[model samples]
Target: MLDKVKELNEKFKTASPQEVLEYFLKTYKGKIALSSSFGAEDQVLTDMILKQDKSAKIFTLDTGRLPYETYSVMDNTNLKYNIKVDVYFPDAKEVETLYKEQGINGFYESIENRKRCCFVRKIAPLQRALQGLNIWITGLRASQSITREAMHLVEYDENNKVIKLNPLLLWSEEDVWDYIKTHKVPYNKLHDHGYPSIGCAPCTRAIKEGKDIRSGRWWWENPEHKECGLHKK
Candidate 1:
């Protein structure tokens, strides 16, 4: 798998995101899937992928804490595309245990608590979403944060034991929005207000102008620790 991932990176190094999506969606078929968070980049990919193959596997993790706007976009995307995106949710028992161990909103107290909440809400559900899949597509961009800048267009996710494919790995923030507007893609309303990044409601917030794209997420933590353990290598 490592050798194959390296080969893919080299072969598609200069290819457009569409070309990469075309090849993999045909070659891998049901073995590949895109995991969207309903953010700008994800919305752009959702539009592109569905245009290529309407039956393409596109899924999202619905952490119970997501904002109402995110849900609204989710509904709008389904209505516009005429496709129902698969949704993965945290286990009820685990969520109950999480609440018992750390009261609601406990993630704001410390980095450890935040990560614990993230693990149950995002990571666990993500693992279920990735099951039986060979390629895990994401909306990750290199400029999003320090943690992701080092990632390649194609790399092996050792934790998930799957090939992680980042189609928009090189897209800029402007590029994402431009595609959204040009294609009339349905996007989260929060982006218009100021939230460049979106996650579970309590873990995300709006940022001031000139801040890093991911700064609004986990604002209390250092830049290096802002990840929710989903895309970490």
Candidate 2:
């Protein structure tokens, strides 16, 4: 599987994002899925994927702490595409346990607490979403942040035990926005207010101009420790 991922990466190295998505949508068929957060990059992928295959499997995790703007975009996306994106939620039992173990908003007290909250709310549900899947598509780009710089267009996710495909891995910030504007893709309104990255409301904030896009996410933690365990390197 690892060797095949390398081969696919090399094969699609020069292909457009749309072409890359098209091939995987047809080849993988029902086994492939895209995990979107409705950010600019994901919106671009959502537009491209649905345009090619309206029945493509695209899903999002509702952490119960997302911003209103995120919901707005989600609603707008469904309206525009006329397709309801599948949604996953953290287990109610687990969420109740989380609150008992660490009081509500405990994630802000320390990095450990933050990671625990993230694991319960995001990672665990993501694992459920990825079950019975062969290909896991993401909206990640190499230039988005330092943690993702080492990622390839295609790689094997040992944790999820699935072949991961990053169709926009080589895209730049300008490239993402260019595609969005030209395609009239619906995006999170927070992006216009200085948020380059959007995540759960409590954990995300807006970055200043010329700053790293992902700086807004988990701003309290070091760049090396910023991941929420979804896309582990």
Root-mean-square deviation of every model: 0.7, 0.8
TM-score of 1: 0.98
Among all windows of 10 consecutive residues in model 1, the one with the lowest summed lDDT is 1-10
Error of 1 at 53 (Å): 0.7
User: In model 1, which runs have C-alpha deviations exceeding 4 angstroms?
Assistant: none
Assess each prediction's global lDDT (C-alpha) against the native: 0.93, 0.93
TM-score of each: 0.98, 0.98
Pairs that collide, model 1: none
lDDT of 2 by residue, 120-184 (tens): 99999899999999999999999888899899988999999998999999999999999999999
Q: Can you write out model 1's per-residue Cα lDDT over 12-33, one digit (the tens) per residue?
A: 9999999999999998899999
Q: lDDT at 229 for candidate 1?
A: 94
